[model samples]
Structures are given as structure tokens and as C-alpha cells.
Target: MKPAPFEYAAPKTIAEALDILGQNDLDEVKLMAGGQSLMPLLNMRLARPSLVLDLNHVEGLDGIREESSGLRVGAMTTKRVLEDSDLVRSQYPLLWESTVAIGHAPIRNRGTVGGSMVQADPASEYPAAALAFDMEFVVMSSAGERVIQAEDFFVTYLTTSIEPGEILTEIRIPRLPPGTGWGFQELARRHGDFAIVGALATVRVESGLCCDPRIVLFGAADRAIRVPAGEACLEGAPPSEASLTVMGDAVFDAVEDPLSDVHASAEYRRDLARVLSKRAMSEAMSRAS
Candidate 1:
């Protein structure tokens, strides 16, 4: 199937793009980054926008830089770039792992970081990683720019807090503190396929006790979510089998409504959440300093 007729614009500058967006009805305008996600929808005629604003030509929208606070990643930066960055591999292993787990090399080469975040797929890895790392999203519009925390950014399946006229510009990832340990695990039908269930964890071990643990689960609900109940179960607890079991159970209980799809049943996803949570937490604890 081919996409329906639509007006196209390739803006070289963000200001130019914002101007075009401001002049049109936002609901009729669709933003395209790498076009990995949007193209499929367009081709299927699921999304028939009147105007397609392509951001590939927009400058300053693709790069990775280190800052005093953390890493500043441009919205158009590809997943493959993140996978190949030495800085990301060494310092942000969680992000690196998540990027690599997303599809194959060809998909990674064209899939943009911000595109995946904005696409807000429940089965995608980045959203779960965002929550685990407490990342911030920076969005812009003709009005101005604002930062949205990960907790507030994701609304539900294929939905986000971004306003109709806003474009996600950058993602801010806080530096993982020293002595922190991270683990990422997901179960897919195949290695490169979308995960049926996934879990991400970050923890710091202090005096043989888990400190400031974070557990996030994807492919188990409408949106990737941080399991505070699961985190609470591990906080200040020794990294013991018993503690992990409790954490796993808490994670299982927290997933009130697991998504049921052709890939898996709700019961299966809920169980995978329990098992993966324990495995991820155990791996994180083992790596903690």
C-alpha cells in the first residue's frame, strides 16, 4: 500500500520548521525524523496527514555530547550511533544494551532516538530505559521549550505528554553515579524482534544492601512503568535470593493489566515480568561495587 497524498516540507532549521507548524493545524501536520515508525503507518494509510514535516535536513538535531549534568542527545541521533559510541558503551551500559536490543543493524541505522521515544510503543526498549535512568525529555514549540520528566512524559499506548504543536528536541540522561550497577533484559520471539516482555534495573550496593534501586518493565502494560512497589521491596535489603523473590512478586503484582496481544497472553507477560525482574535485579546486584 502507498501513503495517501500529503504536502511535504524539509526544513533546514528548527525555526523554519516551527514557523510551518505554527501556520498549520497541528492535527493535520505530522513530524518525521528517521521515518522508521511513521513511514510504516503512512504506507498503511493508518496516518494520513495533510502535511509531513521532515526533520532529517534540520541541523543541530543529531549528535551526542557530554555535559556537567549528564549526556545531551539530539532527537535525530540514530540508535546505531548510540550503539557505536565509546562514551555510551563505557559509561551508560544500560542505554547501550537497550539500543543494541532494538531490531537489527539496518533498523538501528535508521531509527532515531527521539522517534522511538515519541512513538511511545509499549514494547520498545528506550521508554523503559528512560524510566530506569530518570531521563528528561526537552520539547519545543513556537511558544517556547520545556522539560518533561520520564514519569510524566509517557501517557499510554502510542501516546505521550507532548502537545500537538511541540517537537521533542533532546533527551537528557543523568550520569549513572559511581558504584551503580545496571542490567537490561528482554524476551522476544526472536533476538531482533520487538520484545514480548522486558525489564531494566539499576541499583547501588551500599554495605551489602541494595540502595536506590530502580525497576522498570515494558511489554507488560499500556506504557513502560517504574515499579515503585518492586523498588521498595529491594531498597536497603541484602541481595539475597529471598529478597529477589519478594521483589519479583512485587513486580508481578504491580502489573495490574498486562497487555494481551498476538505475541503473548496477559498471563504469560505477567509471569515474564516476574521472572525477568528477578534476573535483572540479580545481575544488577552482582555488578554493583
Candidate 2:
């Protein structure tokens, strides 16, 4: 079915878009950037907003920039640009590796980083990567702007902390210091399908011991699950087969409340988590070494 009849506004500037959004009842207004996710909802009549505020024509929301802290990507930047970016590939290999697997080339051409994060699909790759890297989001409203850490931005499956009147303007990724190693792995039914289970591991090694290691799991929880128990097992320990074995077991046991769906059973997802955790951590450690 086609979407319900709605007014469409394509604003050329951020201020204009904000003004349009602010003037309407936020619940009745929906923001459309890439429309990669929203269009399907609209086509199904799942989202029947009164006004669709399109941001494609808006200026200042389509570039990648490097900052003293890290890299800043405008909300409207496409996934394909991210995948092809040399800076991203070199400085943040995890980001590029994860993004390159998001979908087929055409899908990536139209999907935006902000759109995917705001969609908040539990199986999404970007949100999992964001959590793994401690990324930040900058949100704007007619009133002003505020920054939100990735941990707090994703609230639940298909939900986020974005207030109705606010727009996610940019994503900020912190620079990984020297000695950082990262790995990303996902299990999907097909090349471009949503992951059945996905894992991201980042390890920083010093003096032959792992430090500040993080393991993030997705497709097995309401949101990306950070495996603190897994990290704890690896931290301050030599990155060895024994440590990885222990960490993988801890992560498998620590997985809690995974929902069962047609894609897989809870037990199966747990097993995947256990297996992928070890694989990712091992790859990451090898890179760091």
C-alpha cells in the first residue's frame, strides 16, 4: 500500500528544516534524510505522519571531516562514501569494514549513518560499531543542540533517545590511539541480509598485555550488548589461546535475554556469540601484536 497522504517539504537549509519541524506537532512530523528505512515503513502504512520533512537538499550535512579528537561525519553522508573513504579505511578500519557489509552497493548508496542509527534496528551493524567505538551523536533542535553518547542514544529495538523535534546532525568518532586493533564479524543468511549475529572487538595492547579491550554483540539483544565480562577476562592478560577460550566462555554465559525469532533460536544465537567472540578477539589481538 502507498503511504497515507501527507505534506512533503524539502528544505534547503538546516534552519529552514528546523523551522518547519518546530512549527508542526512533532508527533505528526517525520524527518526524512536518505529514506532508506523510512520509505519502507511509509509504504507499509506503519508510519503515517502528516508531514515529511526531507533533508536531502539541506546544506552542511554531507561531508566527513577530521578533528583534533577524531572524525566527524555529517548525518546525511551516505554509507558508500564511508566504505570508500581512504581516511576511514586507514584511521578507522573497523568502521569501513563494518559499513562495507551493511548492504549491497545500491543500498549503501542511499543509506545514511544517522538514518540507520535512528532506525535503531537491533540487528543493525552501525549501531553495534558505534557502541564498540564509543561514538557520539550531535542532535539539534530549534531550541539548541546537545551531544549524546552512543551508549545512551540507542534505547531499544527500533527506538532511540531522539526527541520528536530533534534532528541528529552529526556522528563523532573518537580517534583510536596507537596500538589499537579492531575486528568486525557478522553472520547473515545472504550477502546483504541483516545479521543473524554480529560481533565487534577492539583491543589495545601495551607491554605484551591487553588493555582497554571491548567486545560488543548485536542481533542477540534489545540493543547492542557490551560484554563486560568478556572484556574483563581479557584485560590485563596476555592475548593468548587460553585467555580467549576463557573470555569466549564467559561471554557465552553472560548473554542474557536474547529473543528468539524465525531467524534463529536463543540457544543458537548464544553459541554464535561464543564462537564469534573468540574469532574477533583473536583477529584483533593479532593485528595489535
Candidate 3:
């Protein structure tokens, strides 16, 4: 299979890209930063774009900058670059961990952060990372720019709130609060395969009690879902086996009717969600404490 015939353009500036998007926005104007995901889709004939917009020469769309609020990551930042950056490894270890969990080395070498989120695979780690970290996505378009919360960004599987002619510019992640813990866990068919079940947990621990508990899961449903009910079940409780079991049950109870495929059965995936979530939460709370 091959994608339908398409035109290509490389725009150096945001304005130039916007001009292209404006003209071809409704004409399957595909944005191409890296060929990691789009190439495959194109070859499989799953996505047939009339125009491919290359964003390489688009400056200011790559790099890691820090500010009083937290980390501001350019959309075009590569997974390998983020993985190698000392600032990310030292300060945002969970994000670093998630980076490694993305595809294999070759894919990571060229895949961009923005592409991953824009692709919006339900099992993809970026969406979970953004939701787990409560990040905000800044999108730019001819109409102007607006910030969309991560929760709202992921509208459904392979879909996002980004409108046509809009490009994701950057992601904003708040600095980890003091005494905060974080963890990322996923159960994939293989290490690099799309996960059948995954979990990301973050919480603030104070005086030996959990506060601000947050647990978000991926790969078990159509989109990533925050399991506050599961988190609430862990409130004020130590990470004991009994407490974990209860929280795990809550997650399992909340995550039912998961999509079944060759990788796993719906029931099995839901069960894995419960188990992985508990382990992730335990590790995250341990680090927070």
C-alpha cells in the first residue's frame, strides 16, 4: 500500500508554515517533522495527505528551556535529545524514563515530541506523560494561539483538539513540587511494542500521608483516563499491600471493557491495568516520600 500522491513544502518560519497551512489546511496538509509514524502510515495507505509540510527549518521549535514556572519543551524536540539532556534526566526523571519507553532507538532518534502527541495513539506514552504531569500544550494557528490543557488535547484515539491550520508549538510542564513523587509503568507485548496496559502516577506526600494523588492510565481504553477514584482510594494510606490491593481493585473496577486484540484480552488488559497501576503508584509514592 502507498499513500495517494502528495505535494511537499518546507517552511522556515511559523508565518510561512501558517501561510501554507492556510492555503492547504483542508487539503490533507500533513505536517512532517520526523518520518517515524507518518512514514509508516503513508506506506500503509492509512493516511493519504495531499501535501506534506516539513518543519525542520522552522527555528525556535526545538530545545529545552527552563523558567520560574517549569520546563518549556519545544514541540520538535527529539526523544533521544530529551533522553540525553542532563536537565531532563536530573530534574524530570519520570519524563526521561518515559522517553526511553517510547519506540526503539532508531525511532527515538528521529521521532519528535510534537509528532507523538499530534499522532495521539491511545497507547502512546507522550499523552500519558502530558496528562500525568498535567502539562499544557500551546498551539498556534492563523486565528492566533491558545493553550490547551493536556486533558482536553487528547480528545480520542488518534485524534486531538488541535484544529486544522494549527500547529503545536510547545509543551509546558510545571516543575515537580517539593516532596512530590512520580512513576511510569506499562505492560506491552514487547518492550518496544504498543502497550496493552500502562500507568503513570504522581502524588505529593506530606507527613507520611498522601496528598494531591493522581493516577492516569493508558492502553486499556480509547484514550488515557485519570483515575482519581483509584487515587482517592489511596488517600491517607500508606503503600502497604492491603492499601495497594484496594487501590488496584478500584482501578480495575473503573477500567473495564478494554479493547481486546491479539496482544491481550480485554479482561486481561484490565487486570494488568490494576496490577501495573499499583506498582507504579507504590514506586511513585515511595519516591515522593
TM-score of 2: 0.98
Best-performing candidate as measured by TM-score: 1
The TM-score that candidate 3 achieves is: 0.97
What are the root-mean-square deviations of the candidates from the true structure over C-alphas?
0.7, 1.0, 1.2
Per-residue lDDT of 195-258 in model 1, one digit per residue for the tens? 9999999899999899999999999999999899999999999989999999999999999789
List model 2 lDDT by residue over 120-145, tens digit each: 99998999989988999999988899
**What does candidate 3's lDDT look like per residue over 1-289, in tens digits?**
7777989899999999999988865757789977799999889988889898999789899988999888999999998999889989998998898899998999999999998989889898989999888899999998899999998999988999998889999999888787789888997777798888889998877777778888988898888889878989988887667878999999999986788988789999889999999889888878985
Give the number of the best model, judged by lDDT.
1
Q: Order of all candidates by TM-score, from best down to worst?
A: 1, 2, 3
TM-score of each: 0.99, 0.98, 0.97
Q: Give the Cα error of residue 122 in candidate 1, in Å.
A: 0.7
2 or 3: which has the higher lDDT? Answer: 2
- Candidate 3 residue runs with Cα over 4 Å from true position: 25-27
Displacement of the residue 188 alpha carbon in candidate 1, Å: 0.4
